[model samples]
Target: MSESVAGREAGSGIPARRLWLATTLILLIFVLLLAAYLLLRKPTEVTVPAPVAAVPAPDPAFATRVRQLEELNRSLEAEIARLGRDPSPLACPPGTARRAEARPPQTPAIA
Candidate 1:
């Protein structure tokens, strides 16, 4: 063991521990290089996510128009109910004849 240490010393009689340190560092460098090569052998692909479509905003004008038409229908229904109780001839009178004066004149048949 002493002879091996003496052989490992430099001409200036430096400690042989430097050789062991250098050998250990070289082994560590080779191990790191091998690990890096294995990790980079196959490249991994990373993809960015696609953007989502935006939702359409609700239209207040459309809602307002629908409400107006519905209200108009309700008013017409009320008016019809009121007219049913009236004793007017214009409100579909009972047993009415087909009066020619109330209708458009019939056109004569052309040859």
Candidate 2:
């Protein structure tokens, strides 16, 4: 074995056994502090809200608002039915070409 590794001082001058003891003491102290903290700490109180009833009471205006919305929906459906198929492309303002009218060059069909 090498003299440095086998020597009592191990070159740092502090004995190897003393260093090992110091490390073990520090670890023991840390564990004791942790255990004390866990045992002495106060537990928090948890609050749970009461459960809601299965059926909630309806609002006074709920029925009237629903009836009014149904009537409006029916009227809109009738208006759409009256305007059958929309007339082909509404007129584009003077200078602009209609999108349907603008065509890309057609390629000749192969025999």
Q: Which candidate is the best by lDDT?
A: 1
TM-score of 1: 0.32
Runs in model 2 lying further than 4 Å from the true structure: 1-14, 56-111
Off by over 4 Å in 1: 1-56, 89-111
The digit string of per-residue lDDT tens for model 2 on 1-111 reads 577676745655666678999999999999999999999999999999999878868776998899999999999999788766554366566777646778855899999
Q: Report lDDT per candidate.
A: 0.84, 0.82
**Model 1 per-residue lDDT at 111:** 100
What residue pairs clash in candidate 1, if any at all? none
Compute each candidate's TM-score over C-alphas.
0.32, 0.37
Give the alpha carbon lDDT tens digit for every residue of 1-111 in model 1.
Answer: 988777766543554567878999999999999999998898789998999989888799988999999999999999999888877765545666567669855999999
